[model samples]
Target: MVEIVPFGVEAWLNKREKSAKYDISQSTIASLTMHEVLNLDGNNGQEFYSMLDQQKMNYGWIEGSPEFKQEVAKLYQHVEPENVLQTNGATGANILALYSLIQPGDHVIAEYPSYQQLYDIPKSLGAKVDFWHIHEEANWYPDINELKKLIRPDTKMICLNNANNPTGTILDKQFLEQVVE
Candidate 1:
């Protein structure tokens, strides 16, 4: 029985997302109407609407279409299309990855002021979660020395938003390479 704490940001948004006016707190793009979406879609972007070519859309491939996987693989340098997994979305992908890799009593370190789901999910799964706090004085970067201190022989995982979500500050390639080593 997982005793998950109520997600604060989600709860706050659910209570006011529809009713609030001048809601500037939103980090993601505001919802757009179908009409606006249609206008936004370009000449070849009828694909966005899945302009049906009378193709029977069954469950399709278990790992998504080969073409789709290939296209996704193109975005990465060394990744193969076969290695590219097509999940429902970011949250679903996160859920799958965390559930697959995390276990009860495992030690996990996640960035502070990140999407709560990253840390909260691990906690709910019985992981000992630690906050790797980011500082505004350092442009929201977490010191590598601090991270080294957090690491232990028993540490199971270190979760990061990659491109610090909510704040939108990116962890450059060099910084990530240093973390890897």
Candidate 2:
């Protein structure tokens, strides 16, 4: 029998031990409810209730509504609304991008001590995943030279997280572009 392990976010959430001493891992809805900050009349609550009240959900929009896509497109100056295809969240978007772009046996480089999903999903897809470790001593940013050394002929993808979880380190655009180049 083959042993099946959970992938991506599920694996991270299912961990028996906390990843950090101060990790306050919990449900967002439950936390908001406890704090009394989750008002039903708020933006999401109102939209959610309106949808629920609809006589027919009817899959709503197949690839999400054009208006919704347009709104999302506004976030990027260069990206058009037609390019937007909404998913469950950022995690879903990341998974979709990886699944659509990455192939088996491709080499991928991912930032370390960040979101496990960033690297794990590629690995699960049979990609040879390499880590670019962020040193705590160096304020959690990986050395540029170290990253340059990791890039090779087989490298197909590079994954990173902005405002890295647990550590909360944000990668600036300049550094990100350097990695891209």
Candidate 3:
């Protein structure tokens, strides 16, 4: 069994969220009701009842519904509807991806101070994980030169967060192009 460290942000939220008047620590937007979600999906609020009556709501689709997958594919350059996947959430997606890719003795470079899962899962998988520091001094972006230095011949994977999570520092396309080059 893998031993993962406790997630502090969740703990803090669980402990402090109820009492806190203005919660800046809330990572996502306020929770929405099923009706609000259906409305946002461009359906009438009553669609939830229609869905429950017409479709099986007991379980999720294996690869997501064709309609949902097609919508997801539209967001990417060349992704196909058949190739698009749906996970439970971001953390589950990260776990699935990291576990699938990283093997023992592999070299992985993950952005420092990003989501803990990005670095932690790879390290636990027996990969030699390197941190690509993103500091405020050079702005939030990791130094491309530093990245170049970190890449070894044995490097199996490079983990980059387009937007560093806690800081919400985004790496734009031109900077990404430089990294790819």
Inter-residue clash pairs, candidate 3:
none
Specify the highest-lDDT model's number.
1
lDDT value for candidate 2?
Answer: 0.78
Tens-digit lDDT string for candidate 3 (1-181): 5666667777888999899988987557799886777787476756666767887657667878889999999999999999988888878888899999888899999998888788878888888989999979877888999999999999988888666778878899998998888
Residue 69 alpha-carbon offset, candidate 3, angstroms: 0.9
TM-score-better candidate, 2 vs 3? 3
Which prediction has the highest TM-score against the true structure?
A: 1
Superior by TM-score: candidate 1 or candidate 2: 1
**Alpha-carbon local distance difference test for all models:** 0.86, 0.78, 0.84
What is the C-alpha lDDT profile of model 2 across 1-181, one tens digit per residue? 2222455455666674256555455323333562244255566466656666885857688899899999989998899988999899887899898989887899999999767777877887888889999999988898889999999999999888877765778888898889878
Q: Each candidate's root-mean-square deviation in Å? A: 2.4, 4.4, 2.4
What TM-score, computed on C-alpha atoms, does each candidate reach? 0.87, 0.77, 0.86
Off by over 4 Å in 3: 34-44
